[model samples]
Target: MPKTTPTPGVVITRSTLHKAQELAALSYGSVWTGPSGEESSGEAVARHLEATAALLATNGWDRIWTPPTPAQLAEADAAATTETMLRQLLDYIREEERSASGRLTAGDALNRVARTADGDPDTGRIAGDVLDLVVVALTGHPSARFGYWSERLNRTFADITALLTAGALFARTYGPAPERAA
Candidate 1:
């Protein structure tokens, strides 16, 4: 009998060392808790991989990408807005702390946001953001540095993931049968 080809499934593109540099920067910055001098490109890569592995181990999500339901998307949208407002508040507090006590704890800002928010603190979006960051760090390609990396990477990946996720959701919601092939 003739040999048959197996169906093509998900294709994961591995990160090249050059590509990994950018990812390392983004991922390391995302979870960095060490002193200023502690982070290097190589160290960032290690931290990125470690943090991603830990999240995967804890979450037990076998699939790399899952389409979000309409409700989940709405929740994520709300969470994103909250996160933006919180970041602005945190920045202002940091400046105030610099001029006053010369020290500020993130807990203070986070607690204040939660306390002041009028409605539900839609924290579920944080999980989605975290997952998106992990995915980008795990798969992103390196490029020329333009500006502040942490903010730039987060924004860049957020937009990218949103587009990709929307496509996935569209397919899942209205696409043809999975059995049909090109």
Candidate 2:
């Protein structure tokens, strides 16, 4: 294959490492606190994930992504309005926290889905946006970052667990399907 020339007026994206360096600068510069005093770096990433999710939500990310299911991974092809789907997710979070036992906490559900969300990017990104909402929506509950991980992996896995938990939350809403009768 021959090297291709760039199109005029179009910009190429920076390398992932470069992009990460930029975000890392922003991530560390940020400061957030709760009743417990300063948040952990991972906790700060949780807040950043929440803000990033909110920005994506406002820009119509949800409308473009389908809910996860037994049949498919999430795709940027949802038919529902972003607001409608986000509302349902919010309502579902409320329902789960209000009464659903052993199944509502992102901090824990993240454990399994996190267990599984290892190699897929799309599934992970959608799940990140979704879990940020869930953990934050649940309120008073510790985020997976703060609740489940230690300092060494805090910031890195905070991002990972957020995505995994979001995927888990959406899966809870839409899939894994009913068990077949034995």
Q: Write the per-residue lDDT of candidate 2 for residues 108-167, one digit (tens) a residue.
A: 332333334231223333344334333333222223332332122222433434443343
Error of 1 at 98 (Å): 41
Model 2 CA lDDT for position 91: 70
Measured with C-alpha atoms, the lDDT of residue 18 in candidate 2 is: 38
Model 1, position 69: C-alpha lDDT score: 28
What TM value does model 2 have? 0.20
Candidate 2: C-alpha lDDT: 0.34
- Per-residue C-alpha lDDT of model 1 across residues 83-112, encoded as one tens digit per residue: 776776677666654544312122122122
Stretches off by above 4 angstroms in model 1 are 1-15, 19-41, 62-182
Please list all clashing residue pairs in model 1, or write none if there are none. Answer: none
